[model samples]
Target: MKNAKPDLVYFSGFYSEATPFIKQLRAEMKDVKFLAGDGVKNDEFIKGAGADAEGAYLSLPSPVYTGEAYKTFGDLFEKETGIKRDASPFVAEAYDAATVIIRALEKVAQEKDGKLVIDLKKLNEEIRKTELDGASGKIKFDARGENVGGETPVSLFQVKNGAFEQLKQ
Candidate 1:
């Protein structure tokens, strides 16, 4: 809880959605986790972008995240662009939008007609209490109006006869 004067905190993200809160957290000397990728085959791209590899592959899912049992994503990438990539990260992130909507819906439910009014404090509070399970995994809100998936079960794809299919949970 950033506002409640917690002792320690951490943040992990890749894009601008993470910027505003991290900037505020830094002001209070909070601990924000910076996750950099390593083990990426494209070292040249990382170097060109002024980034260092932290044992992660940028712009794609890691083998562990993707479950590494499917080849469709890899095959599709090759078919489209003559390059292969892991799709776990991108595919799993579909819940990003769903979580956003679910949280908003939860708040709007407070009104009889499910219409929401723009109140920053109420939005933040309602969001913090949400614990909806999403397609990617569990999307629980934290103190800072951010949905967090802390060690939730991620989706896994299975490969059969050189094809990848989404596995039912």
Candidate 2:
């Protein structure tokens, strides 16, 4: 393989599996670029691959709560859990999902003659019609119950100087 000149290579596997391959291949082929999936986007991959990870690229759905505008939620989470920002990509998405569900429940809840009643059918419909600004950007569902509108951002990052840096458009 050293005689062959390839510009790029793609690795698809969990970090544990892919990191060793990346380290080995990078040692042999210094000029080639490596692209990986979301599995290798964590700290373990960087630590395992060491210097080989530099210049590696990976792309994944952008976690919407990392920006300056979302500092309040980030601060609160860190304060409560003692976890730093960007520790998990799903935190903001989970929060947004819960918010959507709560909003739907509120809209579908009704006050009877005296007590509160919740209709499951109406709650489902309300959930389908949910549209709001959430922690993970705008939350709007299509007929298929999939997010269809607003900024669904994908981020492309490169490992540089032992850290992942988001590339500008």
Candidate 3:
């Protein structure tokens, strides 16, 4: 297996990543920086998070957002030498997933029949064809929403004296 001395102890397959690691991490009482929803496939690890840890995982309909809308998101970035971008199909898919569902609901609600009649086949088609404008711009769904997005590199940079200054992105 892995013989490397890792500075970062990443639990990739959170669902299958096992609970022992989570228990150990919790018992250790150190701050456990988690990316559980960022494509961690281990079911056990994901299941281990507390009910209050809902926001800790990344999945469709994650309710995480900045309290101040339209404000710069620079302060939420990691300032290490490395930069993380999330243009993954997973995120885009999630956005698309949300959009399609919303559109389907809207479509179903508009019918004059009054009673809501949700068509799963039509819903699936709409979900497949979702083109939505979400918090992260346009999102299009493909093949059951397994797609994701890469980080935006923290934007909204500042200009300094006729020059450009890089902010968080």
Model 2 C-alpha lDDT per residue in residues 33-104, reported as the tens digit of each score: 899877777877888889989999987787455454357666887899887656645566777788888988
User: What value of lDDT does candidate 3 attain over all alpha carbons?
Assistant: 0.42
TM-score (C-alpha) between model 3 and the true structure: 0.36
Clashing pairs in 2: none
Clashes of 2: 0
Which regions of candidate 2 fall more than 4 Å away from where they truly are? Answer: 1-5, 63-69, 101-126
TM-score, cand. 1: 0.33
Q: Give the TM-score of candidate 2.
A: 0.71
Instruction: Rank all candidate structures by their lDDT, best first, as comma-separated numbers.
Output: 2, 1, 3
User: RMSD (Cα, Å) of candidate 3?
Assistant: 12.5
CA shift of 55, model 3, Å? 21
Name the candidate that leads on lDDT: 2
How many residue pairs clash per model?
A: 5, 0, 29
lDDT of 3 at 163: 26
The residue-by-residue lDDT of candidate 1 on 1-169, one tens digit each, is 5566654343345433333443454556434333322122232322332322121212223323333223443454558765434322443344445556666766655543676456667666766777754444456767776656556343333322333343533
